[model samples]
Target: MVTSLYIMLLGHLINRAFYYLKQKWESRALPSPESHPASQGVLPMYPG
Candidate 1:
């Protein structure tokens, strides 16, 4: 019974960690203003 409980807790922790890592990866992979060509190329006439 104790072993089964430990296994269940471990499984939950692993699943939570997987989701947290996936979210972190997705946030880093997304493109932002810095990734735009115009932003990286020439300065804008006026700051928007």
Candidate 2:
């Protein structure tokens, strides 16, 4: 169905976006946490 295709596309897009975002994030020189913080689940926003 067309709805299924749309859902699949949205899922793929979200996966790719997260992948790229993580790549861009690690490329930064941001310091690692002093110990993993509770906020660690919140990735930094891409400033581009």
Candidate 3:
């Protein structure tokens, strides 16, 4: 029982770590919002 619990905890930690890394990788891969053409003037707040 204790071993199972430990395995569950380890799996949870690994899942979280992978999720964090995926977010970081995606952010780096995608273009920044400021550089997007729509962000320039299409949006009210941005006001290109």
Candidate 4:
């Protein structure tokens, strides 16, 4: 039981870390909203 709890805690921490990294990466990689066609009303839906 203790081992299972420890594994669960580790998995939770790893998931959280990956999620945080993805958020950071996406924020850096994606273009600004001003350049997005949808945001500018150029297109009713996302291009892709």
Estimate the TM-score of every prediction. Answer: 0.59, 0.55, 0.62, 0.63
Please report the candidate that would top lDDT against the real structure. Answer: 2
Q: Give candidate 1 regions above 4 Å deviation.
A: 32-48
- RMSD in angstroms, candidate 2? 4.2
Report backbone clashes per prediction: 0, 0, 1, 0
Score each candidate by Cα lDDT. Answer: 0.63, 0.68, 0.65, 0.66
Worst window of 10 by summed lDDT in candidate 3: 39-48
Rank the candidate models, highest TM-score first: 4, 3, 1, 2
Which scores greater on lDDT, model 1 or model 3? 3
Which numbered prediction scores highest in TM-score against the true structure?
4
lDDT of 3 by residue, 5-33 (tens): 99999999999998787666645654464
Identify the superior model by lDDT, candidate 2 or candidate 4.
Answer: 2
Q: What is the C-alpha RMSD of each candidate to the true structure, in Å?
A: 11.7, 4.2, 9.2, 6.9
Candidate 2 per-residue lDDT, tens place, 1-48, comes to: 999999999999999999887766755734665354654547555232
The full ranking of all candidates by lDDT, starting with the best, is 2, 4, 3, 1
Q: Candidate 3: count the clashes.
A: 1
Deviation in Å, model 4, residue 21 alpha carbon: 0.2
Runs with alpha carbons beyond 4 Å of true place in candidate 3: 32-48
Report the candidate with higher TM-score, 1 versus 3.
3
lDDT of 4 by residue, 1-48 (tens): 999999999999999998787667645655575566455434333432
